[model samples]
Target: MTDNFYMLTWNWLADSPLLAAATEVTTKSDGEEGTFVLAGVLLSLVIIYFASKLGGELCARINLPPVLGELVGGVLVGVSAFRLLVFPESGSLAEDSLIINLLQSTAGMPTEVASSVFASQSEVISLLSELGVIILLFEIGLESDLKELIRVGPIAAVVAVVGVVAPFVAGTLGLIYIFGTPVVPAIFAGAALTATSIGITAKVLAELGELGSEEGQIIIGAAVLDDILGIVVLAVVASLVKTGEIQISNIIYLVISAAVFLIGSILLGRLVSPLLVGLVNEMKTRGQVLLTGLVFAFVLSYIATAIHLEGILGAFAAGLILAETEKRKELEEQVVPLADFFVPIFFVCVGAQTDLSVLNPAVPSNREGLIIATFLIVVAILGKVITGFTVFGNPNLNKLAIGVGMIPRGEVGLVFAGVGSASGALSEATEAAIIVMVISTTFVAPPLLRLVFKETETATEAVDKVQE
Candidate 1:
């Protein structure tokens, strides 16, 4: 049956008129290329929007966070399930993508053109996804109280330190000792455990109307600090893996630059916000406030990326500074629609990149990784959870909520896995284990965060009523 099908497919392909013509046509006209690229992008966006909305709606109906639903929806339509939404980042070529295949079959887009279009379309969608998260962080920053965030800085610093250290040490040591894994691979896996996905947690907190709460502020602060520390750790680990020696100067440079980029941008943005206000007031144009806000955020985002730090941090700083202005209320209202459009793209893309088939123990090779993943998952959760308890002098704060908020590793963890795999620094089992850890935490943390926060809120309200 397989040989007969292959023979028939070859015969059909050999008889294609367009394929013969396209084979000789090495280049397409600029207009032709543009039209094809746009079509692919439009179709991909349709899939993204529909998947995100349907997933979000279903999740909302179940009283779960809508973001969780968007993620699951992406999984359903993405490589792991339907292959409807896929990306180049996961080692998938244009041929592996169903979207590209569909376009090629329907629109007569040739293989070479399809490949180019796929690359361009994926990069555009990825950029838009990046923009979505930056806007999300900016919105989160706007909602946050700078004064409160500053007040919790010392505690957050402590939490960040512990969060990074506990996971790195425990994961590395446990893997090496218990699993008999090699030193470098174990360290890389441990590095994967150290990421705290501020974007995911912040979005959840916003949805729950707890963005400005004490626990929320601590989680945000620690998470921001965690972001910086995680980058430095990743740099150190990647260097160590590549060169067999850590570069002290590079480590110091990353630390200094990240600190300077964040602190410097916030101070400068605050100083310039007055001018921003004046500029906005002078302009009598529609969308003046929105455009100005986005430009400022994008400029800072560009600066941060150029300086080797997270762009979202710059966007967040921009929001914090801009929130101090009298036009904050207006700006906040303006940014919401943009967030509504772009933010789900980031979440959905994250989900689409995730290949959940690795989790299936039905495959004999997966069982070992599954066993190792169980260990990493436990460590990843407990590692961050312990950080919340380390916060001193905040008795009324929901410590568990703060801990749970830090639980999701999300995309940051994925970076560690991707890097480890690319660098050949991790063994097959170790890579699978790290991926499983990330996938488990990324999906698990959302519901757990809501549960912890909800329980804390219920307890607080009950006590308030009793006191009243």
Candidate 2:
């Protein structure tokens, strides 16, 4: 049976036209390397352009996040079933064959070259992803009214702290005790749960017309702090992993750096606003200032990487700084096209990395994989929900609603999962669990939030009637 399986796999490999062409090219030099490189580049661009448009249309039709569509497109390409059904290559096309052969040959290359190429590709993808995230953050900052956050200060603080603490503790304990995973994996699992997709929650609030309300302000403020705390936890975990000790000095440094970055960015934004406004007014060159702003963002992101902080952190800081400028609206308008082009790439690449074949339910009965996934999901849900009870003031307000509002993990969670998997800190099973957690969180938030907001509105109307 084993031999038959091997034979079948070999036959499939041999019959692949892509594999055959790649071998012929490498062996006989039938085509120029430049031609192959150009073809690869064009293919990637074509895939990205059409997929993004198709995904956007599908998302609008289904009322789903456009990101969801991008992911679906990636899955269609990466998954075997989709590839077989759609492309249906019978191993004849040289272009397809060459690509397959090139990938296989590259896989067997010397460790250094292979690693270097992988790292280069990963870095390019990451840079594009960071650019998308920066633009997203800038939009968030531009839309935010700081006065609203200040009005809900105490409640926001309580919610943010609870949101961070509960998830970290529950996730760590669940992984360690329930799944019996190692301490490092448990730490990473816990860290993954800490990110709250402010974007998702804010979108829901906006749709319901609650975005300008007190509860909305509190949720948004808490989300900002939640993100800050999440990154701190990640840095702490990474430190512990590398040194086998959670260095107090390192923690202090990260905290201080984060504080400085946040505070300084806001201050700088305010101070630089007049000058930026003048420059934009003076230049009168359409979109040139926005281009400069992008360059600044990249510079800050590079600096953050140099200082051992995440590039997105620097990107966010740059966005915050730019937020206070009078030209924010114009900048946002100019940046949207670039964001739209690159953001889907990030989502698609993430989806491509997910191999669903490992998720087969029939194999490995009592399946440790399924068990871990279930355990992580429970922890992910319950932990975030606990934050609702942390509301310090206004007992009448639904703190549970606020907590649930912060539940979706989104892109940041995927970043943590990818980092851990790449570093070999997380096994395939654990990575799958994290991915499931992200998907669940994304899918569950909007409907849950709508229901909670409806209840809140009904209660408010009743109170108003009584007062009248």
Candidate 3:
């Protein structure tokens, strides 16, 4: 009766003359409107930003990576919990209005009402999040000296190959054999598991002040290579699923294209960068260096997209070239603020997209998802751990640390699952399973990384003490 009355009050308020007048006052003229929509987006970003800050600090207090907190913060406000940050849907007022606010504030409205408003602006937010990711990869590339990457090249290649191959075999066989899932879905599971979250690994290494360490360099290099391999594997699996037959030539072409895009970007960027940098150096305009760097990043990102590779690859390549510039330090310093603001948003949005309800055991399908998630997590960990042994450089370096660094699946795994879901190739249960696996990997990797690295530090100290 109380709920019904509340609903009645809301319905009445929604139709009230004063409320309509107030809404009209907020809307703009000249055929443009949606003041409330803009308010909602701003409110969403504010909420996300603070939540991410709180979450990150909390993780630091607990001796975990800050990204872990950011992700959890997203989950808290996302559909999994408070439903504060949501992707709005098109529907009747009732389905959209889960909460009602008489306060006439973006933060106070019905979740669905906000959703409806936000749905119209989702593309804008998505574009911003995409920019955040590009900046992140670019930062990682800037940190990576070409000479360091080249030094670790052989071991990184081996680690990447084994890392990808093991997980692919593990995830595919485990899903098909254990769960009796279809071939296409099993393939997706494998591809998803094979991804190494370079952002997570790089962040963790930087947090530990070990980004320049031998193990760290190997982990970063291997992760980049792993991403390249993962992309090819995904394309091949997707093609196989779509065509219902293996197209060897197409697979070869994709492989070549991806390789050429990565290698070609580096060579071409290096070759032409001096000319570009000289032009920018001559510019007397304010923020010339910053603007020129951004232009270069965006252009490379576009080229990567044209070749069907992820745009971040291009941004990363741009960073690699720019790292060699005389103004590299200035560029890094200038970009830091931009990275700080946007990177957390990307991670939080990732967490927000997770639907924990899918893990409910009471539902038969969700229970199946949970089971698959469990199996995939095991396979994901072991597969990466196996890759550590494949690395032959720096015998004193902790292979386990490298393995742990590679464990997080982050956004790339989500991309694989998303592509599968979007194509209608995966069933709901499979989709949920992949999501569970991705989230599980993400949540687990950070703490494990801290643990392994801490242990390595402790052992080193002990060895030094004994020698002393």
Candidate 4:
């Protein structure tokens, strides 16, 4: 029966013009490229969407930040283990084989059909991921209250400066002394450590119900400033790497540009917001004003990036400037859905890049790599922790908690690692070390915050009873 069917199939192929043309073309030509690319993108999206949702739920159940779940999901998808489950044939094509050569050659073809396939499918997923980050930053900005930051001005500034400087110095010194790595990579690694992940900190504060309190305000305010400073540092380091020369004039320009952008954005927002509100009120369509504000945020973010400043700074500044407007709540409500979808993509992508398979318990035997990693970790921790000592006034406030709150490295660290690796400033060992620092910072912040906040709550309850 199978032999007869094969004969019939051959007869049909011989008789049909389309089938014969397709067969002559092979998978390398126009025949199978669409199918493979479509499959790859669809598979990626399904995995990402489910992983994000599952991670969010798991994080909440474990009393940890939902970002943790997203990170874990990213890791699962990135690792060889998960890839095998999804794409069993990936990375396994034998050499000198017709199928493998066709797949490889066809992959590079600039055919209209292939481009259309990528644009229709893969491009959308990539765009959604990018949009997720933009909206996420906008929401972060919307949630930020500048008045609270102003109220804690001096303290926040001090904390931010100390926080940036300490880890930077310690990290650089550790690399130079312990690893004997080259100057550029060491500087890059140290710079990566200097960033503090305020998102994790903010989430913990909200969970602890301290987000509206004075101390909480101070920490959040400092973190905002810290982010600004961190970006400036990244810009400077990047400039140095590119030119092989760090100019004092360039550093001055960067600082001035950042300051001007921040002040100008707020000033412009203040001037425009009244008119914006009036327009929104007149329109009365659901989310019209909020959508307008979001567009404005994106515009400002684009302008900032054009001027060599971080686009997120502009997005954040726009949010802070508009925070006091009457339309703030409406804007927040309108933007929440967009934020919910895209933000997890940013976190998951970050996690996906982390390759933990290379991390070994026997790293110590690697001598230099192990020592450098350990030293960098210690420097990363202590430098940020000591920033708590810089907290002025309120001797009763837990500076340790504030310092610990600033520990996670987040996107900023990844930026540094990417720049360093791309520029050939970092070796594999150094890059791995930086990744370890990021992982350590992310893992440590939540539990430490939980314990500190718990103790603070107990103490507050005791004090309230005493006052009564």
lDDT tens digits by residue: candidate 4, 354-445:
65644675665344555577887888888888888887668888888888888888666766777787888877788777877787787678
User: Which candidate do you rate higher for TM-score, 3 or 4?
Assistant: 3
lDDT of 3 by residue, 1-468 (tens): 999999999999998999998787656331132655565556668878988999999999988888889999989977788766655421123233222122144344444344445555455566778889899888877777877888888888899999999989988998898889998889888889899988877877878888878888889889988888888888887888788887788778778887888788889888888987899889999998888888899999998898888888888888888898887898888888989988887888888777788878888888878878888889999999888887664679799988888999988888898789877888878888888889888999999998999999999999999999
Please give the distance, in angstroms, between residue 435's alpha carbon in candidate 4 and its true position after superposition.
1.0
Error of 1 at 128 (Å): 1.1
lDDT by residue (tens digit), candidate 2, 307-348: 666666566556656766766777777777776676666556
lDDT of 2 at 18: 89
Q: Which residue window of length 10 is worst by lDDT in model 4?
A: 84-93
Off by over 4 Å in 1: 1-28
Give the poorly placed runs of model 2, Cα more than 4 Å off: 1-38, 79-126, 150-154, 198-217, 395-401, 422-428, 446-468
Query: Whose lDDT is greatest here?
Result: 1
Minimum summed lDDT over a 10-residue window in model 2 is located at: 84-93
lDDT of 4 at 281: 80
Residue 426 lDDT, candidate 4, scale 0-100: 79
> Residue 117's C-alpha lDDT in candidate 1?
85
Compute each candidate's TM-score over C-alphas. 0.93, 0.75, 0.88, 0.81
Best by TM-score: 1
Candidate 4 TM-score, true structure as reference: 0.81
Clashing pairs in 4: 132-342
